[model samples]
Target: MTSSPAAEDGVVRADVWLWAARMYKTRSIARQAIDGGKVDLNGHAVKPARSVRAGDVFELTRGNERIEVRVLAVSERRGPAPDAALLYVETERSIARRQAEVALRRQHAGAPRPPGRPDKQDRRLLQRLKKSIRD
Candidate 1:
């Protein structure tokens, strides 16, 4: 299937676009992820050069989780503070669900590890760390 050509101004790498869009933290990580088949656009796997347009839906997988995001604009380079925000939009529902999960996980993550057999040294370290964290 033929896709539309990239904007005449310039075509940016898909990975770069994702990073600039704040979908990913770093361009290299984005490219590695794409090359590793961790990224998809409109249900189709894409290389790093595939042109990105507004309203593009991308499914990205990292570790054991996958995320769906929509594009709002494309830029050849990462834009400045305000302009950078014109990049992509994570659906509200997606945001809510993800935030909820993160909140729940964080709640548990911050809890003390199950009280099991902790040797004297282990217990002391755990206590110190927990105390430090509390402080």
Candidate 2:
């Protein structure tokens, strides 16, 4: 069997591909993520030295966002966002899952804060309460 041109020559280091694809801010960070097991290749955890080729799939977890992308092209150099986007195609299921996670986070926003710090009178009352408790 034969592979397409991109697949044939699409081999690239996983960290480089990740950085070139703009998945991480820099190659070093990408490497760190791979070492930390935050990046998975083809359903298994991979090392930074792993090779990423066209048609390969990667699952990346960044904090609360879990992304799954299929490699479409490979580049050794980092480029503009549009160019980087050409390197991978995010799966629809991944997009939907990420969105759902975002929505879930939004639904459980942190506890509401008080309007402001206690006023002078409020502070005085609190102080008195404290003194009484200490007595």
Candidate 3:
């Protein structure tokens, strides 16, 4: 197999790095995220082809979670989870914030929900509440 450009140089494309690091499932998805402005390098939005080097900081949002990582190595080939883990280090602040957000979600998720569809009386109350808000 042909070696990737990153094998020769110390830099790799941002999208490729993201996929290789397991941040995104595939390179195309990583490219899409970059194009959508969901990925940033050194605190600024970067294109998929942007060159990423060791020690560069990347902040990206994947679904509801925001992740920040510092690049430790560069690779273009997608690897195992453990290998991917070696590519970057998530900042401690990022880990703390993610944990806090997860805890908040867990707290809200503990709220009891109705077991089934709303009863007629419950639906009526909801309709009245909606009408009042529109008025």
lDDT of 2 at 68: 99
TM-score of every model versus the real structure: 0.65, 0.75, 0.92
The order of the candidates by TM-score, greatest first, is 3, 2, 1
Each prediction's total of clashing residue pairs, residues at least 3 apart in sequence or on different chains, is 0, 0, 0
Q: lDDT per model, in order?
A: 0.78, 0.89, 0.94
Q: Candidate 2: misplaced stretches above 4 Å?
A: 1-8, 114-135
Span of 10 residues, lowest total lDDT, candidate 1: 1-10
- Candidate 1 residue 49 C-alpha distance from true site, Å: 2.1
- Top candidate by lDDT: 3
In order, what is each prediction's RMSD in angstroms? 9.0, 6.1, 1.4
lDDT of 2 by residue, 1-135 (tens): 554454357687899889989999989999999999899999999998788888999999887688999999888878899999988999999999989988888888976876899999989999999999999
Model 3 TM-score relative to the real fold: 0.92
Encode model 1's per-residue lDDT on 19-125: one tens digit a residue.
88766678988898999999999999999878777778888887655678888777766667678776766777667877887888888887767578989999899
Q: Which consecutive 10 residues in model 3 have the weakest lDDT in total? A: 1-10
Candidate 3 backbone collisions, by pair = none
Clashing pairs in 1: none
